[model samples]
Target: MNQFKNGDKAYVIYRNPHTQNVATIQEAIITESPENNEELSLFLMDTHYPLQDDYAIYTTYEEAVKMYNYYFEDNEQSEM
Candidate 1:
């Protein structure tokens, strides 16, 4: 299992049962999911503004960081 720590950036991937469109992880919140027997859930904020919602979770901190960099790499590349 991947270990996720607080403050780590992550990408949430989930398909809404209704729309069936892939959801984006705009934000990551490390917390426990009461419905899943207190298992840790990475709360993801949807990229769709005004409809922001928690989407999915990452198994490890490294995975989360990788996702973050992948999504926002343009900014880093410009700095280099």
Candidate 2:
């Protein structure tokens, strides 16, 4: 499993179940991650506070980085 300590950046994509459209994508620092679990409890960067909602959890740090770029960098590239 990819280990992320506090302050490491992480991301999650929220999609609408009915429409299957992206509701929102959140990027945050790794505040807390339970042992042996896929969930990463976090402080939402948007609010800088813990979020009780769905958040992204990657098994590998590389996967997290790729997804972060997939949502952030890809959009930035398009906008330029």
Compute each candidate's TM-score over C-alphas. Answer: 0.35, 0.37
Which prediction has the highest TM-score against the true structure?
Answer: 2
**Model 1 lDDT tens row, 1-80:** 24554445555554455775333434455555545633555555432211134534465456755665665555568779
In model 1, the Cα lDDT at residue 74 comes to 54
Which pairs of residues clash in candidate 1, taking residues 3 or more apart in a chain or in different chains?
A: 2-59
Candidate 2 per-residue lDDT, tens place, 1-80, comes to: 24666667766554556875344555556655454334545655444434444455654557776876787678879999
Clash pairs detected, candidate 2:
none
Candidate 2 ranges with C-alpha deviation above 4 Å = 16-20, 32-40, 45-55, 58-80
Which regions of candidate 1 deviate over 4 angstroms? 32-39, 45-80
Predictions in order: lDDT: 0.49, 0.58
- lDDT (Cα, 0-100) at 21 in candidate 2: 35
